[model samples]
Target: GAGVSQSPRYKVAKRGQDVALRCDPISGHVSLFWYQQALGQGPEFLTYFQNEAQLDKSGLPSDRFFAERPEGSVSTLKIQRTQQEDSAVYLCAVQRGFGYTFGSGTRLTVV
Candidate 1:
């Protein structure tokens, strides 16, 4: 894709269910980022990947949160045992040329 792309723009999940959010960065982009935006708050960095290696994951809230980009193009963020606090917009972005390409994001709501 010419720009970043994400699937399942909206999602509703049971309290204990697990969800996987996907993102596809623009072609040839080498940097990727995952951010979580809670309602009424700014997006917070969740993880960052430079090519296949995950450069940083300290921003991930907990062990239940996992992100990966094995092939360095498409990435996925998985959350286990969804909780109300996990409800937010998951944003994916790719960095290049001193700027970023961002996806529309996936909205997740856990009941």
Candidate 2:
């Protein structure tokens, strides 16, 4: 991928349903990050992975949220038993030093 790409750009889920969002990071990027952005708020780091290793996942709000970068390139974020509070944009970024490229995001709406 030339830059980070996220699929569906938008999603709507019923409460208690599960949803999965996808991200394709820049080719060969070693660092990938997932963030959650609520409306009018800055992105908060949800997890980070270096290559295929998940170095940190402390920011995930709950056990219902999970992320992985199996091949160290593309990643997926899955939310189980979605709640109304889960309605927000899920952002993906690939780190290149202090610079990171961000995807437009998948807006998940749990109604």
Candidate 3:
């Protein structure tokens, strides 16, 4: 299988717009993770899944954010009522071998 892949490379959302960010992991990987990184800040864990079972979702900042990996292959991060401060890079990673493979990330901007 290839490395982790994320889509929409870039996104522009007007304030209050809803968005879904997607991530496709390498086949056979058993663990997946998502994070949100604000400018000049390190990535903040958003969610984690192990074989379709959502193991952790402690870092989601508000009720407006949600994530799921129903079949353990593809995952989606949905943000409702997007706000200006919601702009950042949304990242996904999959555990592979001894480490993790990460996606290029989705740069989100809200105006």
Worst 10 residues of 1 by lDDT: 1-10
Where model 2 places Cα greater than 4 Å from the true spot, the runs are none
The order by descending TM-score is 1, 2, 3
Off by over 4 Å in 1: none
Clashing pairs in 1: none
Checking candidate 2 for backbone clashes, the offending pairs are none
lDDT against the true structure, each candidate: 0.93, 0.92, 0.92
Task: Point out where model 3 deviates above 4 Å.
Answer: none
Model 2, 21: alpha-carbon shift in Å?
Answer: 0.5
Question: Taking the tens digit of each residue's C-alpha lDDT, what string does model 1 give over 1-111?
Answer: 348999889999999999999998757789999999999999999999999899999999999999989998999999999999999999999999898878999999998
TM-score, candidate 3, is: 0.94
Taking the tens digit of each residue's C-alpha lDDT, what string does model 3 give over 1-111? 258889889999999999999999756789999999999999989999998999999999999999998988999999999999899999998996789888999999999
